[model samples]
Target: MSNQTSVTEFLLLGVTDIQELNPILFVIFFTIYFVNITGNGAILMIVILASRLSFCGPNHVHHFFCDIKPLLDLACGNTELNLWLLNTVTGTIALTPFFLTFLSYFYIITYLFLKTHSCTMLHKALSTCASHFMVVILLYVPVLFTYIRPASGSSLDQDRIIAIMYSVVTPALNPLIYTLRNKEVRNALNRKVRRWL
Candidate 1:
């Protein structure tokens, strides 16, 4: 809950200002989205930049989602505690998973190195993990930049752009990333395309 609040729904300004590109962007995103979902049942998701809004609003959110970071920009009163909470929660959430994921990769890679003598087999194993690692880095780097910092360090426009990377771009690219890396999936997809042709 916020103090000294104005009661109005926010006007959401989306990722870009150019009116002409919306349809083009929409179509591109839609195709990626369709492939992301259809190619597999599900691919990915994350939550960061979660913060309380303590705003006396003019009712404009300069982001597509009315995201907390943007709303925090509009917030009024003492927001230090809100910022602290945001940093703590976001840091804990972000780092824990990232730590676990990295640790898992380390052990897995170590096991592969120690247990396998075949250099070719090791290359194949590492290549398979590359797409997943790319997805992880794609997700975490933006998340870390966005939320794991003092509130003053965050820029709303940058936050919006980073949001696009993780939420829209990452998920959209996931099917391509995973499919291209996987020989079986790639062959199956190629076969399907050949049939259509």
Candidate 2:
């Protein structure tokens, strides 16, 4: 039998079909890339400035953005150190907010149960948290599914789709969810339209 090995290099397709549209596509993608970086960078700066989040690393990112899995993928040599960092350092940084959110909600619910007999007040408190909770679920579930596993080349497309769910789809829907549910945002929008009119 003949021996065969898998190819090391692979090309991502369907991105550059028409030659004339190249610059237009480049401009569009560049704008998107710049916006994505600026927005996330602002958030990262806020988190680091406000909290104790820190990073020092072998700095070559594999994905379009500086995300955990992609950075790990780009690491040279054995990935043991990278994986350890992911498990310990990165995991703590990521999960701290989630844990704190849960803790705060637990306190809220406990207080509502023990102190409040009014169903109206309980419902109002829970309703406010519901929107935030939905957003958290939308973001975290897909991310956890995508990253918290053994990495391999076999499921790249599936991983990309799941990544898009949280990175693109969830963020796109967040404003809509907030605007629909939040009276303050709706009122501000209405006021702006009235002013322009």
**RMSD list, candidates in order:** 19.7, 21.3
Whose TM-score is greatest here?
1
Error of 1 at 154 (Å): 1.8
User: lDDT by residue for model 1 over 71-176, one digit each (tens)?
Assistant: 6668676666656666665686689889999999999899999999999999989987787899899889989988886776778778889999989998888778
- RMSD, model 1, all Cα superposed? 19.7
Q: lDDT per model, in order?
A: 0.75, 0.67
Clashing residue pairs, backbone N/CA/C < 3 A, model 2: none
Model 1 has an lDDT value of 0.75
Tens-place lDDT digits, model 2, residues 35-62: 6686566556534432332335556553
